[model samples]
Target: QGVVDPLGGINTLWPLFGIGNQMLASMALILGTVVLFKMKKQRYAWVTILPTVWLFITSMTAGWQKIFHEKPSIGFLAQANKFRKGLDEGVIIAPAKSVADMQTIVFSNQINAALCAFFMLVAVTMLISAFFVIRRALRSDLPTTHESVVTLRNKEVRHV
Candidate 1:
C-alpha cells in the first residue's frame, strides 16, 4: 500500500454492508412494533431507550477510529505492511495507499450508520407516541354497540 489510494475496506465489504443494512432496517420495523404494542408506557419507553444507548456506543466506537486515525485491526495492519513490502519488492501489484483516504471512507460509513440509528430512534419514538394516543382514544367512554359495529364496503360485499 502507498500513500495515495484509500478505501481498501470499502472495496472489500460494500456488498456485505448493503445486505446488512437491509436486514437491520427490517429488524427495526419489527422491533419498533413490538415496543409499540406494549400496554404499559414504561415498557414501550424502556424498549426504545436501551437500544438508543447501544447505538450511541456502537457509533462512537466505529466513528472514534476515523476521528483518531487508527488502523482497522492489528491483523489488518500487519497484513497491509506485508502487502506493501511485497509491492515494493515487485512481487505484488497493489494500488497506492493514503491514511487520509481510509479515514474519509470510514467517516462516510460512520455518518451513514449514525443516520440509520437516528431514523430507528425516531421511528420507535413515533410508535410509542402513536400507541399512547390510540390507547387513550380507545379508553374514552362510548356506546359499546356503536364501537363494535363493522361496516362493509361494496367491494367487500361483491367478494363475499
Candidate 2:
C-alpha cells in the first residue's frame, strides 16, 4: 500500500480559489444589502448585511494570512522567498529536486501571492463602493433603480 498525502497536490491552488470564492460571495452580499437599501427596505437589509460583514472579515483575514504568514506551507510570499533564497545560495531543497524546480516553485508562489493581493484589492473596492451607495440610499439621495409597480385594470387586461 502507498502512503497518501492528503494535501500533496493542489494545496496551494485551493487556498487561492477559496479566497477568491469567498470574496465574490462577500461582494454579492454587499450588493444585495445595497439593493435592499435602495428599495427603501432598510429594516430587511440585515439579512444580507450580516453575512456580508462576516464573509468580508473572514476572507480578508485569510488572504492576509496567506500573504504574510511566516510559514512556507501557509503563506505564498514566504514560500516564494524561501525558495528564492535557496536558489541564491545554490542549495537544492528536498521538495525541489533541481534548480529549475526551485525556480518554478518560486515563480508559482509569487504568482499566487499576486493573485491573492488582487483579490483583496477588488473586494475592498467593492466594499467601499457599496458603503457609499448604502449611505446615499439612507439619505434618500440615491434614486431607486427598481422598476415601479404598474397595476393593470380590468379594462387594460386582455386575454392572450
Candidate 3:
C-alpha cells in the first residue's frame, strides 16, 4: 500500500460536501416555505416544500451510507487497497492494478439505458417542479404590495 497523501484524502470528501450542500438546501427550502406561507401564498410554499422534503431525505440517506458503506467504491481509504485483490487470478485480462482504477472499472458501464432513463426521469420531475413555482410566482392574484397603509392624517399612503 502506498503512503496516504493529502490529495487522496481530499478526493474522498465528496460525500461530505454533498451532505453539507443538501443540508443547506434543506434549510433554504424550509425558510422559503415559511416565508411564502406567512406571506399568504400557499402555492409558492408548496413548491418550496417539495424540494425541501427531497433534500432532507437525500441528506439523511447520504449520512447513513457514509457511516455504513466504507468499501472502496463507497469511500473507505483503509480498505481500498484490497480492492484489486478480489480480482480472480489471471485468466486472460490484467486485473485492476489499484483501487482508483478498479473503481473506474466498476462504474465505467454505469451510463447505460437504465441509468439514462433514471436521469431523464429526475430531469423531468425537476422541470415540472420549476414550472409550478414559476407559474405561481407569475400569478397576478398574488399580493404585490410589501407594505400597505390606510387612513393617514387627512391623507392616505398605500403601497401598490
Residue-level lDDT for 104 in candidate 1: 44
Model 1 TM-score, 2 decimals:
0.34
Question: In model 3, which runs have C-alpha deviations exceeding 4 angstroms?
Answer: 1-7, 70-160
**Candidate ranking (TM-score, best to worst):** 2, 3, 1
Residue-level lDDT tens digits of model 1 in 68-96:
33343322333344445555565533343
Which numbered prediction scores highest in lDDT against the true structure?
A: 2
Which runs in model 1 stand beyond 4 Å of their true positions?
1-96, 141-160
Question: Any idea what lDDT model 1 has?
Answer: 0.44
RMSD of each: 9.8, 6.0, 12.4
Better by TM-score, candidate 3 or 1 = 3
Candidate 2: tens digits of C-alpha lDDT, residues 105-135: 7877787789899999999999999889888
Is 2 or 3 the stronger prediction by lDDT?
A: 2
- lDDT agreement of model 2 with the native: 0.82
